[model samples]
Target: MTRLLGFPIADHRRVFIIALPMIISNIAAPLLGLVDTAIIGHLPDAIYLSAVAVGATVIGFIYFLAVFMRMSMTALVAQNFGADDMAAQRHNSINGLFLAALLGVLLILLTPAVLELSWWLMVPAPALQNLASDYISIRLWGAPAALMNLVILGVLLGRQQSRQAMWLVIATNAVNVIVDVWLIVILDWRVQGAAVASAAAEWSSCLLGLFWLRKSLALGWHHLRLNLKQLLVLLRLNGDIFVRSLTLQLCMASMTAYATRYGAIYVAVNAVLMQFLLLISLGLDGIAYAVEALVGQAKGQGRSDRVRHWCRLTLLWSCLFAVAYSLIFIAFGEHIIRLLTDIDSVIDTAGHYLPWLMVLPLIGHWSYYFDGVFIGLAQSRGMRNTMLFAALLGFLPLWWWGQRFENHGLWLALTGFLMMRGVAQAIWLKRHPQTLL
Candidate 1:
């Protein structure tokens, strides 16, 4: 309903322009995990597959915690861009990189303790634990590069330069796939090969991102100084986002732990299904990312009407994609599951739960969309609180009751978590519409 020059704005075109490249980039992301899974799945040892699965999940949790850097950077940069404040944008980029570097180093230093704690919590089979530990240890080396890349990607997305962002993602995943195939399949190095492939890819992308940033921004070194007030604001925004991400990760980790308790077969099955879930979420997140940039820009320009219009269009596209994705999963999930693993037990177990994957998009797409809207509006506190309530009140309680149903209970709890997130956030936003202003 946004009008320009007495005509309706073609916001869909704007959304698609940003969202399309991101969708491809996001799809490529899960392919990295799938390649690792497939390569290890064929290695004649279920432990190898389970090890990579658990290790990746643990590393994912760690990396996800730092996602606030990306989210906050995106919001800050987009708003600055809208106001034509190139200086603020430059400051944000530099600060984000610095923060990412600091966090990445801290993660590296804490690797031993993290691995110890993760193993204690996961309690995988002995063989699985050892292999997983090795994977986590090796991948931790890339933490600095990986976190920096997140900031770089955030900068690109915030600028509405999604094409470059897409290229970066493609290049990164291409490296991951090539290395994974050569080391895991050809050399038969197993889980270690996959970890090495991922680490190598992370550093590769980081370097590429640095080169791109230098060329794109062309900023002098003098422009990179940190602003204390902005840093404080960034920290507060990221703090809320960190808590939100933590709660979400807790739900994911809890699901993994519950699945692990059912034995390696279930763990592997859940991992495969999780890939599908990741694929959907990331794809939907593409739309959300587009919304963030567009809405943040509008908000910065003091155009509340434009922000609302963009949000409406984004949600419509998200719903359409959700319906389409659900159908595709219902039709071809079995085929996809088989492609991910050759272990017959893993394949069978995953197929039995394919229905959950099919319905997940419909139930969860709104949360992804809403997250973008909130981030664009700098409503991190609402995001943090909504996730807390959803995880603790909605997910944990449901999980407790659903545990009686075994894996079914686990899936149900997860579904509740996703649905509750969207519902709670919706209610909160409705009650406090000023947050969007």
Candidate 2:
């Protein structure tokens, strides 16, 4: 019954227990990109870094469009965990894996067309296009593993098995970094080396995740039988989240596409700046993930009070973390950019836009926190609606009007998009107070 920071020690302990490992894990996720960028950035031409950036953006566009698998699994499995329904948890995992596999195969099949369309739209320099295509061609092979890994991660986090999830992600990215150094740095494989390293890591992590979850995965044959009702529930939730995720990725990819119009310098600069944004968003997502599990559990137990309590705590922790990120970026943004690249033009161009990155955490944390809350409650409709509103009404207009400013305009659009999501989510929560139940 002891208290700390206006909450019981037990409450605080539970939050940190679920959050710390995730914070570490999610932070490492973006750090992997930073490692990739740093490795590629040191090459003789800025073109290599630009190629990797374009390649990554295109692949991410495809993969993240399907991240609904991970989001839905976490919400569903967490609720099952709260209800102490072990069998249902296993069932959800199995169905999610099946869905993930199917989607992965579809992505692979569409790769040739996607690559052609992506480059056609972006239309970068001829050399950049070829190098990026080289990276994409190899990277797509890991789609199945990467998608499968997302389900594995969702199940682990939903079960509150944060330590296992953390290890899986860390080990995966560690392999990636090591391979990047060997293939890209030592062998000088250029952009293709980075692609192989990432693809290898994805497949390795998929195997490792299965190993870690072997016990939970081992179920009676009956549990493998798909229940149409439960599967429908999963599909419905994932469908909403899919729309939300796709919209979000389109906004992100649009920024990259717009940046290309300004030349390779802008594209390279945006790529470097984006890493800072990713570091902040993914790091803050740790707190959001905790909120998701806890809130979902509380909802399963029919404890509306606990739901509200966790939501409030999510806001508080997210704010503190956002402030910390803003301060760090403001103080050391240039220093960080310098470490990522030796190219003087990239360094200077990225510095010009670091201010946008510095303030993004403050503008964006609310939507992230609210996203966790809604996902926990299995109310992805709200998330989908808010994201659409932000992208359409806020981001597009801002970008159109600000186009004369070039790269700065793109950043401005992104800022508007993120801020709109947070504001809209806040308003939605206020209006639908009953969602806590």
lDDT of 2 at 282: 67
- Residue-level lDDT tens digits of model 1 in 57-96: 8988788788998899888888887777887888888888
Measured against the true structure, the TM-scores of the candidates, in listed sequence, are 0.86, 0.87
Worst 10 residues of 1 by lDDT: 3-12
The alpha-carbon lDDT assigned to residue 253 of candidate 1 equals: 70
Candidate 2 accuracy as TM-score: 0.87
lDDT of 2 by residue, 1-437 (tens): 79876778788778878889988888776677678789889999999999998899888877778778888999998888888888788888888877887887887888889888997787898898899988898998898889999899889888888888899989888999999999999999988899999999999999889777667656665666676778899899889999999898889877777887899999898878887877786667888889888998888778899888988777788899999999999998999999889999899878878889888889988888888888888888899999999999999999999999998899999999999998898899889988877
| Model 2, total clashes | 0
